[model samples]
Target: MPTSHCAYDTRLLVITLILLRGARAYTWSFKEAPSQCGQSTVAVAGNDGTPPFHILIAPFGPSPLPNGIETRQILDIPFTGNQSEVQFQLTYPTGSQFIAVVSDASGFASGGTGVATMVTNSTDNSCFDATSTVQFDFVFNIFPTVAQVVQCQNLRISTPNFLGIIPGGQSFVIPEGTITTDASTGTGFSYQANLRAGTTFLLMGGDVRGNGTGGSVTYIVALGNNDGSCLSNNSPSSTPGSPAGATSSSSSPSSTSGSSAGGSVPTET
Candidate 1:
């Protein structure tokens, strides 16, 4: 009887510890980004009740332990049956590996603390021409809130390889008469950019904090314009030569009334 009681107590202790730890278990993996020049696809799986999470990609290091400079938040991943995948199609300038960290909505509230994985890379500097102009759009669907001023902030753009934030002012803007609203399901905001080809870039869109929620979400996608074809997943070897002086850009939203919430945009200190 004593032995059985001891064993039961141990089991209870273990269960209690696990419960105390909270429900946090996730597995993240990557595959080649759809475009040859773009970054890779990140697939994340949560142990039930992990949906509605936030995944951040940043340069690997200690300074950015939970969240720091060079961090791009891929916001509001929907609850697709305990698993969801997001694809990044940004070109890395020369050498850059992306580190990913995920936090459920609850975890994000207390600061970005959750599961993290090894660095992943999809480097391809020669995606286009350095001198040429490539027009693309940044579309984001951030979580919703009831606050009157539901907005997103800290819209930053950066070069691949985690070099540093682009210095020039925003070369684009959100349309004057566009529909940027806040809905529980999600809200969409669009911005246009005229980036130099062959250069890789990332846009870090943040969620508005004052409005309601925590952590923001954004995605980097290549617009299929007639200027050049959006390259599918292929090896750089397949292409001939690379572009020279490939750079990237970062732009903050002109206004605060955009999407979900907002926070301080991470920049090289």
Candidate 2:
């Protein structure tokens, strides 16, 4: 009887271990079939002289329809030292909204840090109207060294720009009057810019100084026009950039006058 009872207890222990491991694993799913979704290969520069790293993205939200069902999705973007550039694409159901949790997968595990930046442009003239606005929401897991956003005429060429600092959890917006914070949190905030038709902007967040402990950040980018109707087709392409305090030798983009404060353009890594 003693031998039989011991065997039963051992089996129960194994089953409990398996269940605990499965709980930590996260899966990705969507309410409707995604029209476009795929991964790309790219190179990510390391922070403080480390090797290239990878980013893990987990997207979750409800369908745009009234009383829509909620869903989730996951993607892992790998960056190597040999590759120069790559493209990633995802198209959500029309009118639907989602938020993505982005993290430095490899860097966080290895105790390294890096920059996270997403570059997006609107070339479709029809998508904009008199009320169009570009919105950005950033949720910081830990306060990063620096977080800001910039609007440019063209990302490839230097031009006049608009820069705004993202004050995590602050009641006020930076650079005084360029934009306004729509929402505030103890560790995050949201803001919007009334940009003209056909605009290119960069959303930047992450600890480039290797000062932050391993923590994930949430990012949401949306375009709304026609009186608050969400635009679903304008997904931005993300690419890592250089560390703080590094100057680019390239010529500065020409000055273009804007109502917001002006600053030198940041060099992309």
Candidate 3:
């Protein structure tokens, strides 16, 4: 019978390709909503002999929760324009609430044109010059029992004594979003960078050029580790050399008289 009708049409085309591959199997789940999740590591710095700049990160969710996620994009760390310094990592779940808007506005990603400067903190030109984009609207809980905050001040030196010659010790605040322990606290030249939980450490400082004069400056702070390295206090550092532009040699005196600001500027890679 014609070879049994060509073996029943190859067994009905292998049962219609196994039912179309089980109807294009697809499954995804990320449940744990009670409120309070944490993770935010956004660092952007570029604008020195520019020619390459591109770092865009978008993660939005202002209202609508409970399930139907809206405005989702938890990753987009792109920078090939030459790259000065860029870091991006965001993960906030448990009733989520995010607004991480970092931008280069498409200057150079192997394309053309570039200009940036938005290091927000860690004083060193205090960057905000030739801006592009920078937004961080954070609110994380991460399931109760999560308190890792470091807020140390005294960065007010328009130029004088260069802040007592910069020398703070034991400032280890390493925990850039990933939970860990080994805490430390304030001391010496204004130190206060503690970490108990983890995932939030990027307190880089700068202002290099210490030859002496009114511009004799030197401020350094460090505490950023995820494998890149930079504990800074107990030993283990990197990223500390690129403040440039200091050739005054003589002309010091312009202090509102505010000292105590040292230790914690480690992210120069």
Best by lDDT: 1
lDDT per prediction? 0.28, 0.24, 0.22
By TM-score, the candidates rank as 1, 2, 3
Candidate 2's C-alpha runs over 4 A off are 1-49, 65-67, 80-86, 89-91, 94-106, 109-269
- Per-model RMSD to reference: 21.4, 21.3, 25.5
Model 3, stretches more than 4 Å misplaced? 1-49, 58-71, 79-144, 147-269
Q: 102-162, model 2: which lDDT tens digit per residue?
A: 1234223221111211111222223212232222222232111122222211122111112
Candidate order, lDDT descending: 1, 2, 3
TM-scores, each model vs. reference: 0.29, 0.23, 0.20
Q: Provide the clashing-pair count of each candidate structure.
A: 10, 2, 18
Write model 1 residue lDDT over 15-48, tens digit each, in one string.
0101112233544444432222455455654454
What does the lDDT read for residue 92 in candidate 1? 25
lDDT score for residue 163 of model 1: 14
Clashing pairs in 2: 29-72, 158-253
Compared to the true structure, candidate 3 yields what TM-score?
0.20
**Deviation in Å, model 3, residue 121 alpha carbon:** 33
TM-score for candidate 2: 0.23
With a 3 Å backbone cut-off (N, CA, C), the pairs that clash in candidate 1 are: 33-40, 75-217, 157-249, 157-250, 207-216, 207-261, 207-262, 208-261, 208-262, 209-262
